[model samples]
Every structure is written in C-alpha cells, then in structure tokens.
Target: MFIDVLKNIVITIVTVLIFISAVEIMVPSNKMKKYVNFVLGLILISVILSPIVKFLSNGDKEIVNSIKSYEEIFTDNQNKFKSDNVSTLKNNGKEDTKKELFIRNFNKNCEDLLKNKFKEMTFKSELECDVDFNNITFNIKKLRIGIADSKVNKIKKVRINKEKTDNKEENEEYSEVVNYISNQLDIPKEKIEIYKLEE
Candidate 1:
C-alpha cells in the first residue's frame, strides 16, 4: 500500500512540476506571466497532494470497518455474559422455592398422619405442628393437639412410657394416644401441647 501510494505521489509531483516549467517559459507579458504562474502553482499543489487525500479517504473506510467489527464482538460477549448470569439467578430461585415447598408439604403430611391416627382411635381432635428439614431430610419441630367436649368437661392427655405385656391388651384413651404420638414422632412431651375444649 505504501509503495503504490508513494509511486503515485512521485508521478503526480513530477508531472505537475514539468507542466509548471513549460507554462513559465511559454507565457509573454510579465504581469500575465505572474498571474499564470500563480495559477499554475495552485494547480501543482493540488496535484501533488491528491495522492495523500486519496490514501486518507481509503484508509478511513478500512479503519471504520475494523472498529465496527470490534464493537460487534464486544457487544455479543456482553450480551452472553448477562444472559448466563440471569439463567443462574433463575435456577437458584427455583431451587430455594422448591426446597421450601417440600418442607411445607412434609409438615402437612405429618399433621394428616396424626389426624388419621386420632380418627382410628375414635378421638375427635385437631392438630398442628412444625416440621424440621435439614439437607432434605425430615424431622420434628413442634406439635399441638386439640380435643373438643360435648356439653361435658374436657380431659387432657398425659404422656407415659411403658411396655405392654403380652398377656393383656390395653384400652385406647387420652394417655394411650399421647404415648402413641410421643413414641411415633420421637418428640418430647414438652414439644407436644394438649388443649382442652370447653362445652
């Protein structure tokens, strides 16, 4: 590129110089010669500088194209980075929500189990409890039981620990139910509450 531009510049300079010399020799009047020389000088200057102007114009396009390509690459990279970050955030949010939901459902299932057991033993009751989960495993947090009375006094259950003898079967009552729950849930009696309902 430099060589071609240099050659063009040299050729233009030589041609303009020769034309100026010829015009200076051919012109007659001194005043006319001065005017003609001034014009020729201007023309010579334009011709000599034409190669540089052409080079600059051509170089401007190449420079602009390279800068444009670089800008496009940078924009593409920025967009990809942003997209990846958003995807990670969404996945993390989903995981946390899923974990919370799992714990909630497990607690509900525990409450239902207790309700079923109470029903089977003919004990009309309502219960609530909090469940503990660590690393996706279930444990107990707290428990409460409610018993309603029908125009009578309400009796609360007492927690007991005893092994049944093979010779005798036991009748189901408040104490038995409390013991059953305490054993089944592997929770202390302090964590289990019994509410007595008034008629």
Candidate 2:
C-alpha cells in the first residue's frame, strides 16, 4: 500500500510539473511570466504535499464514519425501547380489563348462589380480592353482603339515644348464613360481613 501511494504521488507531481511548464511557455509578457511562475511554484509545492495531507486527513474521515454508525445504532435502540414500552402498556391494559371482568363475574356468581340458597332474602354482594398475575392465583380478601328480607316492607327507625340491643334471632340467622357461606366457598367467616338492608 505504501509503495502504491508513493508511485501515485510521483506520477501526480510529474504531471503537474509538465502542465506548469506548458503554461509558462505560453505566457505573453515577461511580467506575466514572473507571476505565472510564482503561482506554478505554489501549485508544485501543494502537489508534493498532497499525499501526506491526504494520509493525515484519512483518519478524520474514518472517525466521521464511525460516529455516523454509532448514531444510527443508538437511534435503532431508542426506537426498539419505545416500541417495547408501548407493547408493555397495551398488555397491562389487557390485564386490567381481564381482572375487572373476573371480579364482576365472581360477584355475580356469589349473588346467584346466595339467592338460590335463600329464596326469601335478596342478597347484594361486594368483594375485594387479590390476584397474582404471574402465578395466576386469586385470593379473596373481604366479602360484604347486604341482606334484605322480601317479607319485610319497611325498616324500623331507632333513636340515637336508645341503648344498643342485640336481637338473638337475627344474630342466629346471620351466623347460620355466615357458616353456610364459609363452608360452601371455603372462605373464613372473619373475612365475611353480613348487613341488613333498609327498604
């Protein structure tokens, strides 16, 4: 490679010198000849140093090319990261929708089951649950049941100053319902709450 470069430099110098000599011979006046010779001398010097200058500047070209390549790679990685984030967001939205659907279905099924067992009572249920997406497991946290007896049309009003009293019959009925729910759903009674609904 070094030999080839040297050969090309020598050939360029010789060609430039020959062209300068031809221009010098064609000069019309002695004063113009002096100016032309000075210009030709500068051209000759440039022709001789061009190979060395090009060799030094070659590294700069390589650096520019390398920087451009790195920039392209960085842009590609950035675009990929953005796309991955967008896809992850979409997946999260889908999971949220699925979780909501599961909760709604679970609440409806529980209400239907309770309604079937207690025909004289209407049951409205609200439940809180924990779902593990990775493991695909569900844990019921709390279950709230609002019970309204179909036979009762009006709720009795109680004064705030009156002493609190427990109705044994109502307590026993609530306990039985709680026990039945615990046994059927495999849920602890402590997590279940039964409330009387006012009409």
Candidate 3:
C-alpha cells in the first residue's frame, strides 16, 4: 500500500512538472535558459517515470504475460521480414505503382494460401498481413491488415498490414502490429506465423 502511494505521488509530481513546463514555454519570459531547463526537466521526469507508468497501468499479471508473448511475436515477425523473399522485392522510384501491384498480388496469394496453401487459417478466427511500401528499388514501403479487436468474439484472430520502406524500418511497423495482436489476445508466439507474400 505504501509503495502504491509513493508511486502515485511520484507520477502526480511528474505530471505537474510537465504541465508547468508547457506553461513556462508559453509565458513571455526573458529567461530563455530557464524555459529550456524546465522543458528538459519535464522530459527527464517523463523518461524516469514511463516504465513505472506502464507497470502501474498493467495491474493484471495475465495482461503482462500476454504483452511478453506479443513481444515474441514481434521478434518472429522481424525474422520473417529479413527473409530472402522479402529482400528480393525492392521498392524503386515507382513506389506507388509497385505498392498497388504488391497489394493485389498479396491479397490473391493470401486467399490462395488460406484456401489451398495453408488451410489452417480459415479455421482460425484471425488473419493479418503486413507489407512494406517504400522500397524505392521495387517501389514498396509496407502494408498490414489484421483483426485488432476480438475479446467479444471469443476468438483470437489477427490481420496484419505493413509497408516496407527503403530503410530497415519498412518492415518494423508490420512487426509492431503482430506484436500488438499477440499481446492483446494473450496468444503464444509459437501459435502465430509471420505472414508473408510468397515471392
């Protein structure tokens, strides 16, 4: 009980400091250094308390475990992002055109993969795919679609969408989506496969 009170007190103090910093920045003060100090102080307080905030917010052990599982999904998705097929596809100057083609092709492949290739998908309640869109060499960044919410359906399903960029981050957002689904649904990482468009 004491620990909780202390944490709340610290959080409240940090929140007040942020508000004060914003107010200080808006005020017509000749002391620019003081304003900067206030802003920096606010940032420092937030940096220190962010983890605490997350801990406080995730009061449930199950939720926290689910988040860990979600992280694993993200890790696996990243491994798939680095696959040869993904690397082979490049996004050049004509990104938009390639994106359209990739999406069309990806959707077709997903339908086929679910129906003919990986029949297990239709049996599951979730489907997701991620695409990278800004690969200037192939003109693709990332694309992803997935079932974001499923607590009501009593079914766990995800549809991932992503766009790959020229930078390594192109596939990162897609990984985030997968991680999010895994975390939200409390699904184990082993149960989810990184959905990719076959080259």
Residue 117 displacement in candidate 1 (angstroms): 2.2
lDDT (Cα, tens digit) per residue for candidate 2, span 27-117? 8887878888899999999988877788687957765777787899999999999999999999999888888888888889888988899
TM-score of each: 0.39, 0.59, 0.19
The candidate, 1 or 3, that scores higher on lDDT is 1
In candidate 1, where is summed lDDT lowest over 10 consecutive residues?
Answer: 164-173
What is the lDDT for 156 in model 3?
27
Q: In candidate 2, which residue pairs clash?
A: none
**Model 3, global lDDT:** 0.51
lDDT of 3 by residue, 1-199 (tens): 3365468868877787787668666767677768677776777778667657865786566466767878899999888878745555543435556655766775565444434533333312223334465443332223233222212334324335423332233234345544654565454444444433322
Report the Cα lDDT for residue 83, model 1.
Answer: 97
Query: Candidate 1: where are CA atoms >4 Å away?
Result: 1-55, 120-199
Residue 24 local lDDT, model 2: 84
Worst 10 residues of 3 by lDDT: 142-151
lDDT of 2 at 195: 73
lDDT of each: 0.62, 0.81, 0.51
